[model samples]
Target chain A: MFEIKDLKASIEEKDILNGLSLTIKPGEIHAIMGPNGSGKSTLAKVISGHPDFEDPEGDIKLDGKDILDLEPDERANEGVFLAFQYPVDIPGVNNSEFLRMAYNAKQKYQNQPEIDPFDFESLIKEKLTVLNMKEAFLSRPVNHGFSGGEKKRNEILQMLMLDPRVVILDETDSGLDIDSLKQVSDAINHFKSENKMILIITHYQRLLNHIVPDTVHIMADGKITKSGDKSLALTLEDQGYDAFKDNQS
Target chain B: MLSKTTNPKTMELETLQKQARDAFNTLGFPTKRHENWLYWTPDNEQKALERKFYEPSDSIKENDVILIKNGSLRSKPNNNNLTVSNDTHDYQNENLSFNLDSSSLSYLNTSECSEVITIRCRGIINEPLQIRLESDHTKDNSTVNTKVNLIVEEHSSITATFYHQQLGGAFNLTNTSFELVCKDNANVNISHVFKDNKSKAFFHSIIHMHEKSNCNHISYVTNSLLTRHDTNVTFYKEEASLNLKGINLLTGEEQFYNHLTINHKSKNCFCKQHFKTILDDKSISEFSGLVYVAKGSHEVDSQQMNQILLFSDSARALSRPQLKIDADDVQCAHGSTIGQLNPEEIHYIKSRGLTESEAKALLTYGFAEEIIEEIQDSHLKEALAQDIKETVRKIKS
Candidate 1:
């Protein structure tokens, strides 16, 4: 289980996540929907332990252990994965090589044996089929010259490869087209397991239609003002965040 | 009677050598005052003119490999279409005379070299020629001068690989000059691998191309204390093309300099030059390339690019790409870039699970792989790739 209690994070002396509290148990997919500047993405970043954020208050626990003090890679090794909204392009690093390194790092952290190149190749080739990616994509540099939809698919591709315990998808559906959206959603759905927890932070309710969440929370002004079942997302789609914003005040 | 029977070509070469010697005496060694040599200046302790010459004491008798030790050819392969001669005999081609006047180092090489090693290719040569230039391990501070002449006749194709290695740790000064001529419809490829010891090396090469000839020149430099390479190419006829590529990997306190000049003196010629360097520790690298398109040389395409990656705070790079176009219809472009590895890129790689050192090694290897991928010889390509990976490992550790 992943838990956050009164998490107040700031960057450059400006508070982005103000007294936010949430709990996600295994086998539950929760979606956080809010308007612009409502701190949804900041919450995801704080969960992933981004170094840009200053001293954060409260506790972020993974299986009852405080993880806020861990480095980004350390958090990742502890089964925390964040699919960045903007994937960085690293020229000259082959995608397959990068993926192998990442996978082996996690394996070593878990005290597991490293995967041989041939075995890793077979594993990645299987995952590539799930995302409908061509074999040539493995040879190209990481995220270099990739289209918007391709970059998103690559993020999900990484998610599948790592298979972390807590998966945070921050706006993974913003720039994706309908076809790519369907493909990415299918990949995410395929990765869902009974022991894994998913946090989807989005501005619109469109992505929730593809991968229906167990619960929906409406955030405004750096705080979650409303929480309910999946039908709340439908109501928000009909009434808009303005109705909730007025109610919060 | 012997004077009457003297070869006119040999007499002309003697006169040219005398002229070159006079010019060398007047110009002397280069200094910071010379515009073309502003970045490199010899130390006062190292005098180019007052050094002793040593004869070679080691030789390799391999069949496919020609070994040149201490400025003398010790072995050659027997082939029907190729000829190797140590003595200067009637090699005064017009192409050799066109591109040797740009630098005083070439003149010095011409003046001081005792014997010239000439390799002439006539018909199609099936095998690549491997030439190894090695210094004797006598533990003495001496200077060696070597001159090589390569001639490719019409309708022939050949590949040559030159490996330079030093066997001792003395203050060795090496001055090497190469004259490459490709006749009409000939195809030639030359690869130079410089893996010298802690010695100072100065190399000058002049290339001339005839009608419809194609030439490719590739050089790799690594592990030299102080090195400078001066290359000049001229298109003497129409429809010729040239491709020049180089890579330099420097670490520790090494210093490397490359100066390239490409002259398009004819119509419908093409040229491309790409050079990349990786500098680590407190090393420094410099590149200056110039492309000149003379008048009436229309329909010419040229491109020059130089890129450097600095891995340390003290590492430095200076790059200058200049183009001079006098022709009306031509396409020319030049670009140069010097930068360190991107932090965001490194973070991204690290976030994916690699350690900081592993991430850096991967990025550095990727930078040099661009030039290594273009090598046509699989054996050479594999060897270079292994060398680059080892270099990255050494830097990280």
Candidate 2:
């Protein structure tokens, strides 16, 4: 289980996630929908322990244990993975090499033996099939000269490789074409399991139609104002977020 | 200082040597007043220049590889076409001239050199010729000077590699000069590897290319106490091309300097130069590159780029990429960039599970691999890459 209680986080003295509270249980896919400047992405960043947000008030717990003091990589080692909305381009670093390094890092943290290069190559090759990517993608630099859809797919590719317990997809659907959207959604569905939790944060309800979150929360001014079943996403789609501004808590 | 012409064969050479000695006396050592010698100069020990001649106690036998130890030729390769002579030739017809005359190092080298090793390639050479210049731990506070001349005939090709190594804690000074001439339709590839040395070394090279000649020059310098390399190229005829690339790795308090100049004196010539340096600790590096297109040399294309990566607050890098185009129809471009590693890139790599040091090593290796990958010889590339990796590891430690 993953839990965030009154998580008020600020950057440069301006609060972004203002007293936000949420809980996600295993086997459940929750979607947070909101208008612009409503802290959807900030909540995800705070959960992943971004360095910019300092001295966050309230608590974030994974598996009922406090993880507020962990570094970003430590959080990642603890099964907290955030698929960045904007993946950074790392020139001269081979994609497969980076992935293998990440995988080995997590393995070392868990006290497991590291995989050899040949074995890691085969392992990542299998994951490429899930994203319908070519072998050449592994040889190129990470996210360098990649198309928008390709970058998104690479994020999901990493998610699959790491197999984190808590998966936070922050606007992964934005800028993705319909075909790429379907492919990414399929990859996400394939990664879903009974012991894993997924949080999808987006401004549009279109992505929810593909992944079909079990619960939807309407956010405004950095807090969740209302919560309901999946049908709330369609209602917000038709009625718009303007209809929920009066319900801010 | 001209020894009484005991060898009649060198009487003409003695005259030229006297002229060179006079030139060195007139110009003397470079001072802060010289524009190109602004950042560095010979260490305050005036004895370095005074100890001009040191005879080697050991003699080298003849072998297939040219080996110079303590500034004396230890071995000479026995080849029919290769002429290893202690006498000087009238090299004026070879277009031997220094591009930057602010320093008298070249004149000093010419005046003090004991021999001039010359290799004339007629047909295509199947094997690469290797030259090793090594300074052992036997001597301290001494000076050694050597010179080489290479001429490639028409329709011939050859690859030459020079390995310079200095061992021990001696504060020796080494001065070297290389003069090359490429005839029409000849191909020449040369590589220089300067490895861990505690001595102060200065190298000056001049190249002249005739019509339809192709030349490629590559250099790698690793952890030298103080080193300066000067290379000048002149296109004597149309359709000649030059490709030059260099990488420097510096750490501790070491300093490395590179000065390159290309002169396009003919039409339809091309020249490209790329140089990169990685500095750590309190090391310093400087690069000065110039491409000149002479008058009436239209349709010339020249490009030069210099990049530096600094790893410490005290580490410094300076670069000057200049283009002097006198012809209106010529194309010239130059760019220089000096920056530290990107924090975001570092964070991104660290996010993948590498420690801070490991992340830095990987990034630094990646930065240098750009130039190493351009080397055509796999053996040379692999060896250079391994040396770079070792250097990167030391930086983190």
Candidate 3:
């Protein structure tokens, strides 16, 4: 299970996530719909251990263990993965090499035998084929000159390779075209498992339409104001976030 | 310089040496007040200037390899097609001369140089001539003076590599002067690799390009200590092109300064200067290049740029990419960029489970790939790639 208990966070003394709480049991997909500044992305950053935010004040427990004290890499090694909203561009690092290094890092953390480049090659190629990325993509620098859709697909590729227990998708559908959105959603669906917990944070209900979340949460002023079945996303889509502005306590 | 007798050549050299000695006496050592000598923090490097001139062995065996150790000839194979001589008369093409007064070290080289090696190439040579410069570390706090002349005759094509070995003894000083002459329609490719000098080192090189000649040069610097380079390339005739680039990967208090001046004396020439620096720890580096196109040199094209990547907050990068154009109808552009490792980029890599140091090492290596891929020699490129991987691993360890 992945759980955030009253997650209170801030940036530069400005409160962003004020007492926000959510929980997703194993085999569940939770979609978070909110307005622009409603702390959805902040939730992702806090979970991924971004240094920009202030030291969070609540517990972020992964499988009953609080990970507030862990470094970003340690949290990642401990099965926390956040696919960024705006993926960074690493100008000179080869995509294949970066993926291999990330895989080996996980392997080393788990005290398992690390995979060499030659052995890891076929495994990554399989993921690349599944994502429909060309072979030339491996030779390019990681997201350096990639288009918007390519960057999103690269994030999905990373999630597939890392195989984390807790997956946080932060606005992975914004810059993607309709075709890319469907393809990336199909990839996420293919990656779903009964042992994993997925958190989908988005502004619209379009992504939820494809992924069909188990639950929908309406967030406002840094906290969740309402929670219900997947049909709640349809309601928010039809009525807009104005319906929840006055409902938060 | 058309004297057929050997005595006139000797006398000409002797008189030139006398003039150089007088010049050095009048100029002495440069101070911080001089514009060109600004970044020089003198740590008692006057010993090199005060050392007595040493005698050089003249037994010339023409080997493909010319080895010089502390201003003494170690090996020269006679089997190669190159003509190695002590004479400097025909070594120069029409009205060409080494700019000895450009730097104080050039004056020091002319005054104290005991031996001079001149290699003349007349045709296309596939094999690269190797000039290995090593330091004799048996003695403590020593000084060395060495010089070389390379002349490529008309319609000739040649390649050469000047390899500077790692100096590993008591701190000392060295002054070296190198000159190259390219005649009409000549093509020359040269590489200078300087590594781990234990003390102060000053090196100067002047290249004179004649009509329709093209020269490609690259300098690879790593692990240097208080080193300075003065490189000058002058276009003596029209339709010549000079491509010069340098990569300096420095760490741990190493200071490197490179001053490059490209002078276009004739019309219809192209010149380029691209330099990159990857600095770590508290190392310091500066790239000051000046491109001056004379009034009559119309239709000249030149480009200059410097990119610096610093790893530590204490590391400093100084860039001075200046241009002086007295002529109209020319194309020139110069700019510089100094940036640190992006934290967001670091977080993205860290989110993938790699440690911070590993992310840093990978990104830093990628930063230098732009220049590393520019190397035309495959073996050298592979070796350098491996070398940089090791160097990056040692950072913050």
Encode model 3's per-residue lDDT on B281-393: one tens digit a residue.
99999889999999989999999999898878999999999999999999999999999888888888888998898888888888777777766666677877788888988
lDDT of 1: 0.82
Name the top DockQ candidate.
Answer: 3
- Clash-forming residue pairs, model 1: none
Evaluation by TM-score, superior candidate among 1 and 2 = 1
The reply for model 3, stretches above 4 Å from the true place, is B1-11, B41-43, B52-55, B58-64, B77-90, B94-96, B121-129, B137-142, B152-159, B166-171, B182-188, B209-215, B236-241, B266-269, B296-299
Error of 3 at A62 (Å): 1.9
Candidate 2 per-residue lDDT over residues A41-115, each given as its tens digit: 888877876667768999999999888777777788889888888887877678888898899999999999999
TM of each candidate vs. truth: 0.91, 0.90, 0.90
Question: How does model 1 score on DockQ?
Answer: 0.53
lDDT of 1 by residue, B94-202 (tens): 3355223656666666667766778889998877788888765344566677788889999989888889876554366777888899999999988999985666788
Q: What is candidate 1's TM-score for chain A?
A: 0.97
- Backbone clashes for every candidate come to 0, 0, 7
Per-residue CA lDDT of model 2 for B1-397, tens digit only, reads: 2333324233455565666677778887877788778888765524665565445526557798788765666787777656454434634335444222425777787677666655677778767788897766446666677677778889988887889887645467788787788899998888889888877888888888899999888998887898889888889899998888998998889998898889899999988898989988999998998899999999998999999998888998889999998997888899999988776666556555566677788788888877887776667888998888888878853
Looking at candidate 2 chain B, the ten consecutive residues that score lowest on lDDT are: B1-10
DockQ of each: 0.53, 0.45, 0.71
